[model samples]
Structure formats: C-alpha cells, structure tokens
Target: MSRTPDFLAQGHDERDPSPWLALYLDQSTPLPDEVKAAWLTDSSSGSRQYLLPFLRPVARLTIILIQVVKVFVPRNWSHSKLLHRLLAWGLKRFVSPEANWLILRHFHLGSQVLGFIGRNSPAPVGTSPLEPADIDALKDETFLKHDLNLFNFVIRLNQALRDKGLVLGKAPQVDFSMIRDPGLRLSDMPHGKLNFLDLQSAIELFTPLYQLMLTDNDFWRAANSLQLDETIGIYAATLLGAPEHLILVNNKHPLVPLSTLRAGHRLVIHGLSTEMLHSLLRRMQAAHGATPTPEQPLA
Candidate 1:
C-alpha cells in the first residue's frame, strides 16, 4: 500500500496542514491513544445513532420555542444579567461535573491554539503580543459572557469535585494576551457560510456544537479579534509553505435539522470521560510549564 502522506510534513509540495493540528499530533505533547480511540468510538456509537430519532423532533421544537421566546424578548435581553444569572443557576444545579470540566478544558485548548498562532507567526502578520492581562480580559463580561460562564462553571465544578474528595490538578487559564485587536474578520475573508455539501465545512460548522456546547460564541469572537483566520491564512500561505490547499476560505453549508441533532447527540454522549478530562487538564498544565499531579482526577 502507498504510504499515507503526512499532511503536517514540512517541505512537502502537496500537503500542508495547520500547526494547530501539530499540537495534537506531535510526540512532545502526545494525546493518549485510548482517549483518541474513545473519541472515535463515541463518534459512531450505537447510543448516539439510536438517540437521533428522538432528538430530531426535540431539536425542531427547540428552534420553534427559541423563535417564540425571541419575539417576546429583545435580542439584547439575551445577554442581560438576569437571564445569565438564571442560566448560571440552572447550569450549576443540573450540569454534570464532567461536562463542566470538558467545557472549561476547551477554553484552555483555545487559549493554547490562539497563543501558539500569536507567538509563532512572522512579524507584520502576527497578533499583538499577548500578556497575562490580555488572557484575563477574556473573562470580562464586556468581552464575552461565555468567559464568565467559564468562571462560574469552574467554581461549581471544583466545589463538586471537593465534595467528592477529588480535585482538578489545574483550573483552566488563558496563557496568551492581546494588547490590541488583530483587526481580522471572517467576513473580510473569502470564506462563505458553511456548505453541507463540503464534508470539511459541514464538520466545522457542527463540531462546535458538540465540543463547546453553548460557549463557542466567545471563542469565535476572540478568534476574529485576534485575527486568527487571517493569521492562519498567512501561515498557510507563507509558513506552511503551501497556499493552494492551505489558504482558508469560508464555505456556505445548509443545516439539516436531523443531521445536526444526530451530530450533537453523538458528540455530547462520547465527548466526556474521566480519562479524557484528566488527560486534557494534564496537557494544559504541561503546556503552561506546570507539573501534572498524578493523583488529581475528575469526579
């Protein structure tokens, strides 16, 4: 059999992949094989496949209910402190600790991705130098209500863990700072709305729903603010040394309600596991130069 091309291999004329992919594939920061296997299994599990039939109707109903609510409540009220507080209350009371840890771990991974992009990009094409303060700014309500949700989830999860005689080795922290906006916008890029016909675009559009749940908004906004799309474009064109396949473009994709519901259920069901959560925290801690405590485990 012909050897599979290394998409991440540098100096290759035909394949150039994102450095962010390297973060997951590199030997120095190895992801556990079992965790990867679990992700694959969860993606195609029977539970997820069977649940889709029930979830589809519920998802359609949810869209209708949301539209009805929007008519009664102004869009601004969606971000109101009152509504946030209520949501926070519900999350605290109802969401599993495993899910909260998974949610927070995503922010940490996002910070690492953005930070890697910022620090590695060539001069004149990179983001402004990020600082500790810039990372902290991610938690401010003005910047993203989702970050506040992150904080709330962290506190509640930690408390729950403590009650169960477990502790997270490290709480999620942003490691990069942006002194100023990178001024890149997806709207300015040649990208189009996601197109379901393109498999990659379709996956990108729906992956966020399962991975970040309700917290993806701020990450995307932060990505735009940091000019990640543009910066990645530069890396694709200049750094990865391939532009033909590496350049980013927005694609339009139609959302099939049934497909979305199935994808969401599949991802959420298999997304969280004690091993995966702990492994992620350890990876984050290692990236930040902290020692991973072996005894620390998620509840």
Candidate 2:
C-alpha cells in the first residue's frame, strides 16, 4: 500500500517538513488504541449487540439495560431516614423480564459513539425540615445506587474530557484484553426460571461495579490506559465471582508514573500521589515478607 509522501509542498522548500507531518498524523481520526481496548473488554463481558445503520440509530440496548437495572433497584432505597431534601438523582427502572434481558444485551457491550442519558438528572436541594411523609415517600420511590454506578456510567465523562482536549493517549503504556466467554446463545441455553433469576441477581451486583468505572473521570483522565485493567482487577473477583488475581502498576518504571497517565473516564488510582504509593507498597511488601510460602510435600 502506498503511504503519504515525505515531499515538500510547492510553496515551501526546506522549511521543516516535520510540521506538516505532525499535522497529518494529528488529523487522523482513527480510534485510539485505548478506546479500542475498552470496547473489546466490554464485549468480552457479555454484552450482546449487532450494529445497525438505521437513520436515527440510537443506543437502544444501553437504554434497555438502564431500564432493567432500574427495575431491580427498589425505589426508596436511596432515601435518607430524615428526608431533608428531594433530589432528582436520575434513576430509571427496569420493569419486567424482557426489560432485564434487553439491558443485558446492551450492558457492557456497544459502540462507543453513543450516549444514554436517563430521563432525569438529580441535583441537590437546600435542606429543610424533616417530615414523616417525606420519609415514607422516599422509602416508596428511590433506589440505593451509589458511587459504584460510575463504571459503565463513565462513558459520559470521557466525551467531556475529549472536549477538553485530552483524548485517549496516542499509545497506551499498558495493555489489556477484556476476557470472557459468551456461554451458550439464548436459543441454545436450556430454559429454567431459577437459572434466569440467578443470572439477574448476579448481574445486578456485577453491573454496579462496571458502572462505577464508567463514572470515574478523574481515574481515567490521569491514569493512562489501565482503567480497564484496574476495573477488572479491583471488582471482577469480588462482585462477579470471577477468579482471584491481583492487578497493580508499579511506579518504578522510567517512562510511567501517575502524572504521565491521562484520565480516561473517572478512575484515579493511576494518578495516586507518590508518597501514598510508597506507603502502600511498603505495607504490601511487609505483608508478603512476613508470610512464608508453602513448600511442596517431599516426593
């Protein structure tokens, strides 16, 4: 294949061809490798999608997933006992089996070129006198979603960062693959109500973790391309029942450090202050040094 030439322009003789070369590369609109890794990881996590070319193509799958999580989340779960104020804190609901399925289909997998804004976005209101009715109403309405919602929720913030000029770095220092199996297709899997319920409950717990990563713009913007790695390492085993494996980055590398990392969505561990990291590493090393590895039985 022919590549763009290194020749001089008609008007410009030897005036540093480097400037034009950089302009050409900077103008390239191809997706960054980090973004590509994120997408690939999300797909491995079991999101089902088939891209379509409808004129008004929307992220129906993600919307459906949000709706489904809304279903499982009991309303009033987030209301405080005193009920000092009412917040929109946009929370949607998933009402039935179908809604839940649709959500799973779109959950972690989909094109990155889309956004799923809920019907409402809650803002804090001034505190006021508490009321019994407010308490009852809150118990009856809001769900207990918390900061963990940041995972998949982060997609929104990444868009904001690009607008601010820091896009996924041209090359990510670290690499990762979102690893998973699709299980059997819906048509092939045996039908059992119990299994479905188990799946729903299990995912309900798992989705929140990914959603947390989605919200952590600070983490992503500062941490280089390891957001996906940290997300999986931190939450995979605990919330998803995946295997136990540790995920960590060492600050000792010459070219890599918290400051050199760019935030992706919101995860910020990569930008951890060096002093804090030293303290943490000391603790880890101390623990490891104290524990003796088990020896194989004499053969």
- Best prediction by TM-score: 1
Whole-model Cα lDDT of every candidate shown, in order? 0.33, 0.27
Residue 23, model 2: lDDT of 35
Candidate No. with top lDDT: 1
User: What's the true lDDT of residue 182 in model 1?
Assistant: 29
Q: Write the per-residue lDDT of candidate 2 for residues 151-203, one digit (tens) a residue.
A: 33444444544566643322211111111111212232222332222222223
TM-score of 2: 0.18
Candidate 1, residue 294: Cα displacement in angstroms equals: 16
**C-alpha TM-score for every candidate:** 0.36, 0.18
Q: Tell me the lDDT of candidate 2.
A: 0.27
